[model samples]
Target: MSVFMISQLLIVIAICFDLMSFQFKQKRMIVTCLSVSVLLTSIHFALLAQWTAAALMLLAAVRYIVTIFSYSKRLMFLFLAANLVLTVVTFGGLTSLFSFAGGSLQTIASFSKSDQRLRQIMMVGISFWLVNHVLAGSPMAVMMESLFIGSNLVGYYRFYGMKLSS
Candidate 1:
């Protein structure tokens, strides 16, 4: 198979990890699953030659992994700064903004104390990611982001019922 096909296949696997992440009530488990998804997604973007997305995903993977162990506002700030620098360095144009925005939100979400809050932030982040995926020409990543939003909503409802408090 071609590299593009392989990238799509990788995204499919990453999607499974992303979707499964939302189902967990614990933040650590959620971040762990998302870490795997982010790492795989980084590779997928790299294969597609989307350097901005790839670098953002790589940073996101590191952020997720770090947060899974220990996270603070300082750490979040550092990640956000790194993300901004990466986005500027990669600078793929308007499409880069979408991934940067999404990754920024997800970085904030990673530092959230509440699971519901994390999911809520992630929902918004995933929306931005959907646009980035479309612009970057990754149909599978777009589908993954869409499904991730749905899964997050369902997971939120499952855990918190109708009330949406932080």
Candidate 2:
């Protein structure tokens, strides 16, 4: 549950929201929102040497660019297909691209003899990471008032009881 690992997980959830937004034609507003969020995340992680997660966000930038490009249907399909293939490859860690290896439990175990203060710091890092994820990443999974989820529902709250707790 390292901060890096948590943000990485949130990236997946955010990307899912991006995918669904595209699928449901949520317009550039959604893309704009997600893209800006990713930008901020990339910047945040870059500051922390969480290079893997930052690189993922950079890749997200490329995807956003492609999404906004001027292109024919054929070209758009190509971009989409290429983006999907690259996304699967990167997100799957097919070649260790942006791999989230910080919180594999094995990681925490390796510090069994480390200083108590270090262990405490690690725990705090993980918790902060997890909270950052839930706050910044959960919005994409919801579609406001979609009927299947109920006409008056507020997406994440209804689906996962996930409020930002900010």
Candidate 3:
């Protein structure tokens, strides 16, 4: 298969992981699946030469893995700063800005103690990512982000017995 096709396949796998993460109610299982998703996403972005997305996803993977053990404000601040630096370094005008915003939201979401809040914040991030991927012409990524929005909405419903209006 072509390299691009392979990368797209990898993105699909990552999307599956992300979808699984949303389905799990347990914190550890959710974060573990998210970490795997991030790892695969990072590899896919790198293969596509989307360095900023790759860096952010790698940072996300690290953050998920670390937080599984313990969480602290210090770690959040450190990772946020690192993510911002990477975003600036790999800036590509508006597209990079979208990634920055999405990554920032996800970073903040990582610190949330409530699963509902995390999923809510992630929905916003995925929206931004959807735009980014569309602008980059990443068809699979765009589709996945769109599905992520729907999946997150379903997650909120499952968690709270209603849509998260907030």
Top candidate by lDDT: 1
Segments in model 3 whose C-alpha atoms lie over 4 Å from true places: 163-166
The C-alpha lDDT values of all candidates are: 0.92, 0.39, 0.83
Tens digits of lDDT, candidate 1, 1-166: 9999999999999999988999999999999999999999999999999999999999999899899777699999999999999999999898899999999999999999888888888888988999999998889999999899988989999988988785
Q: What's the lDDT for residue 26 in model 1?
A: 93
Over all chains combined, what TM-score does candidate 1 have?
0.98
Q: Which candidate would rank higher by lDDT, 1 or 3?
A: 1
lDDT by residue (tens digit), candidate 3, 33-144: 8899888888888888888888898999999888777668888899889989999898767878888888888888877777788887888888888888888778988877
- Clashing residue pairs, backbone N/CA/C < 3 A, model 2: none
Locate the minimum summed-lDDT window of 10 residues in model 3: 157-166
- The best candidate by TM-score is 1
Ranked candidates, highest TM-score first: 1, 3, 2
Clashing pairs in 1: none
lDDT tens per residue, model 2, 41-67: 565455445454456555555544444
Candidate 3 or 2, higher TM-score = 3
